[model samples]
Target chain A: MSFKAAVLVFPGSNCDRDCKVAVERSTGGHVDMVWHQDTALPSGLDLIVVPGGFSYGDYLRCGAMASLSPVMAEVVKAAERGVNVIGICNGFQILCESGLLPGALMRNNTLKYICKPIELKVENHNTAFTQGFTPGKSVWMTQGNADGNFVADADTLNAIEGNGQVVFRYVENPNGSANDIAGLMNERGNVLGMMPHPDRAFEAELGSDDGAILFRSLMERVAA
Target chain B: MKAKVHVFLKPGVLDVQGKAVEGALNGLSTVQGWANVSHVRVGKVLEFDVAATTAEEAKAQVKDMCDKLLANTVIESYTIEVA
Candidate 1:
């Protein structure tokens, strides 16, 4: 079966191209651009990506506005149907704002937007998204903002921990995120959201090819 | 008529930014007799007014506005008062 994927493009999304390139280059297949206004996604999409950027200029709050777009309603429904959904950076923000994932990304505890390469450890490799890499390995973070801390209630945190829904955790806990959480998954394990942009580091062209393994992992299963 | 709405992260949700601000304040011994304080709570208040005929209408409208736009119901809850 040929793998089909769609990348959502909001008005302020800047990373859609990188995300599409990552998927296309890895799978050697076409990646579709889905606008945030469209009420429906193209049929048979095996995966959907929400790329990072200041969607709606990070207005009201990060991902808060974009989550309400008609496109996200479809995205939420798709995630419900067990479609593989991955949110990166602003995409991660949207997933939280849309209630697809847990917790909220708040301003960094440093009160400054951080843009640097930071190491992150992969906590789980059993999901469709992170299956390509070994669990407990580190990845990279490319940007920062004050509102980047992840927050959730204790019950939600316990549930996430109980189900092993956590995907990535910071070794150094950069943003002071509660429990050092860097990424999350839905209860069903189909939806994954994280702050680091795997798309940004996917190739040697970006000087860090550590990102390729994520897409490669996805393609490996699709091609099998 | 204009009404103001205050939206903030609820009490139990961890306020990292607030803590950062508090940390900075605590670091400043001259600000308010500093050094010993270990915590500070930070929150944002968004003030906006809407045209409504009465207080009850204004309350409902402001609440809806908060739910839909002003406040993120997941991590934050909002309270409104009309004057």
Candidate 2:
């Protein structure tokens, strides 16, 4: 069985091509680059990636404008149907704004854009994306964003923690996110939103190959 | 009719921009009471014309806009004014 994936592209999305290449190389899957205004997605997608960048020029809020785009409506439906969905960086902000994920990505407490390689602990290995990594293993990836600080109310924090939906935690807590959460999954575990750029780190020469394991895990699941 | 929407970060949520502005303002003043600013919160205002005939209708419509897009209610709060 061949794995099928798609990378959604918004107007200001700079990482869409990188995400497509990473998924294609890592999973050996056919990837479709879908446009934001397109109302429909290619049929029979196994995974959907919301790539990072300042969508809609970060006009109102980081991801507020792009979340309401036509393609996101279909993306939300695909997520509801249990297709694996991953959002990275500004994509994480879009997912949160769209209500596909909980909480909000606030401005960095330091009020400066952060761009660096950071260590992330694999907090949950049971999910399809992180199954390739050992439990609690530390991995390296790049984080580049100004509004990557995550925040939610008390009840949401408690529920996500208790449900084991926290997928990854930052080792150094770069953006003042609550609980050091670098990544999160839905209660169903099929949707993930993270700030780090896994696609950017999938190759060894680029920095780290740890991210390939995530795509390989999905490929294995899709092949099965 | 016209609607004005004010969006603000919730009280408990940190307003980093507001804090920075407050700090800058305090640094510019040396008077005893001039630097007494506390609880500085930054917010945004969106003003737009609505096709509603009545103030109540315009408020309701603008409120829907806030809930759907203008404001992310998770860490932000919004107030609507119609004129």
Candidate 3:
């Protein structure tokens, strides 16, 4: 089985091409670039990606406007059926805005646009996304803005932990999330929403290649 | 009919974004430290103008809308009242 993925693109989504390149490289050129205006996702796709960049120019809030785009309607349907979905950076914001993922990613505590490579801890190793890595190791994190810390109620937080939904955690609490949460998975474990850009660290030249393991894991699951 | 929906992050929810905003405002002197802004809570008040003839009907439909979309009970809690 070939690994099929679609990278969603929006008006201000600067990282679309880069994300498409990374996914294509990872999946051996089996990735499709889908526009945000499209009404439906290609059928029987194995994975869908909402990539990074200041979509809608961060107008009302990051991902707030893009959440209402016609394409998200398709994404929500794809996710509900257990099709693997990944949201990175502003994509994470859009997922939250679209209610595919729980809680909201608010502005950073420092109120400054943060762009750098930080450390990440592989918190959950059971999902289709993070199982390729060692259960507890620090990886590299790249890209984010002021509104990046993830917040949810105690019950929702408990549910996430109880269900093994916390996928990745910031080792140093880079965005000040309550539990240093950098990424999460839905209850079904099919939908992954993360603030860091794994695409940025997928290549050896960028610094660390820890992020490649994520794509490798997804591929392994697809091939199985 | 006019309806008001008061939305708030649920109790026991950590408002990290709001806490940081409070701190920043304190630093900028918009509020005194630990006094004027001991804690900052953020929420939205959604006002709706409905065409329902009766207040009860508007309230019921508005409540459904609140439950279906406007509020996320997992992270956000909301109250709906008709005017």
Task: Please tell me which predicted candidate would have the highest lDDT against the true structure.
Answer: 2
lDDT of the structure predicted as candidate 3: 0.82
Better of 2 and 3 by DockQ: 2
Q: Runs in model 1 with CA error above 4 Å?
A: A141-143, B12-42, B47-54
DockQ of each: 0.58, 0.94, 0.28
Please give the ranking of all candidate structures by DockQ, highest first, separated by commas.
Answer: 2, 1, 3
Give the alpha carbon lDDT tens digit for every residue of A1-224 in model 3.
67888999999997788777777776674788899999989887888989998998987467877988999999999999889999998999889888888888876766578889988888888889987888657788586567788888778889998988898888787666868899998899999999888888888888867777888788888788
Lowest summed lDDT across 10 adjacent residues in model 1 chain A is found at: A137-146
- Model 3: residues >4 Å from true position, as ranges? A57-61, B1-83
DockQ (C-alpha) of model 2? 0.94
Candidate 1 residue-wise lDDT, A1-224, digit = tens = 66789999999999999999988886776789999999999998878999988899998888888999999999989988888899988999999888888878887877678777778888888877678886656677455455678888789899999999998888888887888888888889888888877787877777566677877776676666
Ranking by TM-score: 2, 1, 3
| Candidate 3 Cα RMSD after full superposition onto the native fold (Å) | 3.6
lDDT of 1: 0.82
Clashes of 2: 0
Interface C-alpha RMSD, model 3: 4.0
